[model samples]
Structures are given as C-alpha cells and as structure tokens.
Target: MSASRPLEGKVALVAGASSGIGAGIAEALAAAGADVALVARREAELTKVDAAVSAHGVRTLAYVADLADENVPQRAVDAAEAALGPVDILVNNAALARTGPIHDTAPRHWAQAFRLNLDVPFLLSRAVLPGMRERGYGWVVNISSEGSLLQAEWSAPYSITKRALNALTAQIDLENRHLGVRAVGICPGWVRTDLAQSPASLGVPEDELLSPADIADVVLWVVTRPSTVSVGPIIPVRPVSKSAQTVANWELYLREMRSYDTSGGHLIDLYGETR
Candidate 1:
C-alpha cells in the first residue's frame, strides 16, 4: 500500500467494468490503490480492463457473468471475495435501457431492464452487507440516470427501474449508515458513453456531457469522503462545460476512427481502450 493513495488497502468490485463508465471506475479505483474486481459479460473486453487495472500495481480480478441472472450476484461476489478479500467499495454501474411507451413495451424487455438496472444492485448490496457490518465500514455507489427523476416519455421501463434504484439507495443507507456503511445513488444527466455517442447525441456539444472519467472521479470522491461527513439520499452530478466548445480535435478523432476502421479484426482488441 502506497502512502499517497487513500484507498491503499481497500478492495473494489465494479459492475459493467468491461467498458464505458464501468471500465473508467475500475481503473480509477486501482490507481487510487484498491484491488479491483471487474465485472461484465464480455470476457475479452474484461480481460483488457483487468490488464489496465493491474498496471496500477493492485490486484485485479475479471468476473465474466451476466449480472441480470438471479444466480450470478452471489457467485460473482463470492469469487471476488475469494480472490481479493472482502469488497470495501461496491460500484453498481451496470444497466440496460429499453425505450417505448409502457403499453407498447414487451413485458420481457421491461423485466430485463429492471433485473439489470435494479435487482442486481439490490442482490449485490444484500450479499455484501454482512461482511460490511462485521468489518464496520463499506461504501456502495449506485450509478443511476437523470431519467430516474425526469420520467422521460417512451422511456418508462428504464425510468421506472432507475427511480426504484434511487429509492433502494435511500433505504439501504437508512438501514446501514449506523453500521458504518454509506449507500448513495448518483444520477448524471448525460454521459459520453457508447450509447451517448450516437449521431443523435453528437448534436449536443461533447464538452457539455459528462465523460467516463468525470463519473469515475465522482465515485472515487464519494467512497473516500470522511465518515463524519455523511453523504446521500441521492446525489446528482451535472457536467460543467468549459468556456470554449469546439471540435478542434475532429481531425485527430477521425484519424483514430479511420485507423480503427482499417485495423482489421484486431480492432476488437481495443474496445475498452478508448473509454
């Protein structure tokens, strides 16, 4: 453990770590000196993220599993504990969204969204509580969306589940803050994840949207806060845009895109690198 790293001896389990904000959080936690367990369904991408995390000189475990499955939460938590000791910080960053009016949406799609967005967090929190209670310290950071509060039209399923997730965070905090556990829900307006980079989202200035690192920084900050300063029923993070907004790096971006487009099948090797 390095003296400079506040989280030197802690262990962090990050859901959805194969890419996007999840990968960013895993790497950031490792850099802050926590052993990190990366969880996601893509083994290949998870391997890349694990390698990156290990570069920070902390232990890294890659858990490849679909958290949407009811049986996987316990299995993943058990495996992480076996490999890296008890998890001190749990980041629930995995989620799925289905868009459509409630009446038009398939029941199965709604169920899937709720399972991944809400139930998995609930199960993981339940699994980690006993250990946290015994040890007398733990942090659970739930990644939610602004839709949780906005109730966007045609996004009933995702909005409903995220709202429930925020509520769950409050309930967990109420139940466990007395036991040295801090639970909080973080809802960000728009983040520059893969889904947010679509043509439709590009019209908004990129600088106005949160980046993966932005969210990761928030996670790191939340977990490292002094215990005396209690944090959260729910926290909303809004991106503050820089004064100048322009795509001055478009040439570099296009060159990289061209390189990826021509990099043959090996381009798959770089999925987690950009984020």
Candidate 2:
C-alpha cells in the first residue's frame, strides 16, 4: 500500500455522514483511499456527501435511514458490506443531542437519546466485529462529546448518553482486543458545527471553535495507526483555555466550593489562581 493511500482497498461505514463532523470524516477516509458508505436520515445531504466521497475516486454508497430505529443500524451495515466489501472501519458519529432539564424532557426523548447515541453503536459493532475478527482487523471510532465529561447545564440526556458511549468503547476494546479488533471514543468540544450555535457556546470566539476537518484529522490518525498501538479507549479533544461559557460555569463552581472550605488552605484554592 502507498503511504499516501494507506487505507487503499479498505471500506468505511460512517453513520450521520450527511453533515458536520460525519461528512468531514467520510470525505477524509475516502481521500485516504477507502471506499465509504455514508449513512444518515437526510437524503439530500447524504447525496452531497456521496458525491464528495466519490470524487476521491473511491466507491461510495449513501444509506438513508434514521439510526434511532433499532432495526436500521444492522440493515445499514449489511448494505455497506454487500456494496463495498467488508467494512474495515466503522465510525459511529450519529447522536441525538437533547438539551433540557431531565425532569422536563420527555421520557421518549431520553430513550431516543440512548438508542441513537449508545444502542446504535453497540448494534453496529456487533454486526461488524465477527467479520473483523475473521480478518483479524478493524476499527470502531465512536464520536462522543465534551458534554459527557463536563456535564454542562440542561444537557442531561446528551451528556449521560455520551458518557455511556465512553463506557461502551472501553467495554468493546476490553472484550475484542484478543480478536484483533479495537474501539475508541472521541470526545470533542464545541466544534464549528451547528453545535457551535448552541447556548452552551455563549461567549466563545469563532476562532476558538474547532473545524470539522480538525476532528476528521484526528480520526484519520486513530484508524491509520498500527492496531498494536492501542491509542487508549477514550480520546478527548478540546480547545485550549478559551471556551468561555463552560469555563465561566466552572469558575462559579470553584468560587462557591472555596467559600465552603473556610480554612485559609491550599486545598480550597484553584491551582493557577492567587486567591
């Protein structure tokens, strides 16, 4: 295989590939010489990504289905394998981001959040792992969010579901390592997707937000590395010291906690702060 086209002859199945980070990743993989199967509910957007993937002169298939449907994940994988050979890479980039207090959010929304974010990945992994094991090769790249770690306000369902995805990645890696397959969870902070417009990004400057290509570059790095490297189960990608809104909340929390510690001690103080 050529160094410029290290993924030549491989096939990648990417969910939520219609837009944003998914679209970016599908194109990146194709550019690296991998045939890509793009899965998403939006036919129009999916068509656009398919064209882009095809432009790389690699085979491309666009599967239009809502991953929240329990049956759709398997069918998507089945269609991909039939059309482009066995999938060497599976990217679970689909997610349902529900923002609201847990008490106010409907139970159905919570269920959907779990089904799309967590269950879909599990189902897809189950479908592809056996074939990957037989070939002794594969990569499962899960797109979790920074919300999973920060547990930001009014983001219970999103954060909890993504947190579970991290756990799922750890479990999949632990169970499948012997078979020569691996899994990793990618936790990205406010990137320049539609997510950048959310209230959570109140004071963030435009330049501070990561581009979709930024995340895609990381995915390429992850999957292209030797399987023996074990890049760890969770990879957290975030902006450097400039996420305004979330940091503000953290500052508030730290200030309050310091108040409770009445002792004029180092334990109560934030590491970099003079107070």
Best by TM-score: 2
Deviation in angstroms for 66 in model 1? 0.8
RMSD of 1: 10.1
lDDT of each: 0.80, 0.82
Give Cα distance to truth, residue 178, candidate 2, Å: 2.6
Model 2 per-residue lDDT tens digits across residues 1-275: 68999899999999999999999999999999999999999999899989989999999999999988858988999999999999999999998876565667799989999899999999999999999989999999999976676633355677789889999999989988778788989888667787445434255567766789999999999999886688868998876755533334433333343333324422111134332
Cα lDDT of model 1 by residue, 41-93, tens digit: 99999999999999999998999999988689999999999999999999999
lDDT for 76 (candidate 1)? 92
Candidate 2 collision pairs? none
Quality of model 2 by C-alpha lDDT: 0.82
- For model 2, what is the error of residue 60's alpha carbon versus the real structure, in angstroms, after optimal superposition? 0.6
User: What's the distance in Å from true for residue 97, model 2?
Assistant: 0.5
Models 1 onward score TM values of 0.85, 0.87
lDDT of 1 at 192: 77
Q: What is the lDDT of residue 138 in candidate 2?
A: 93
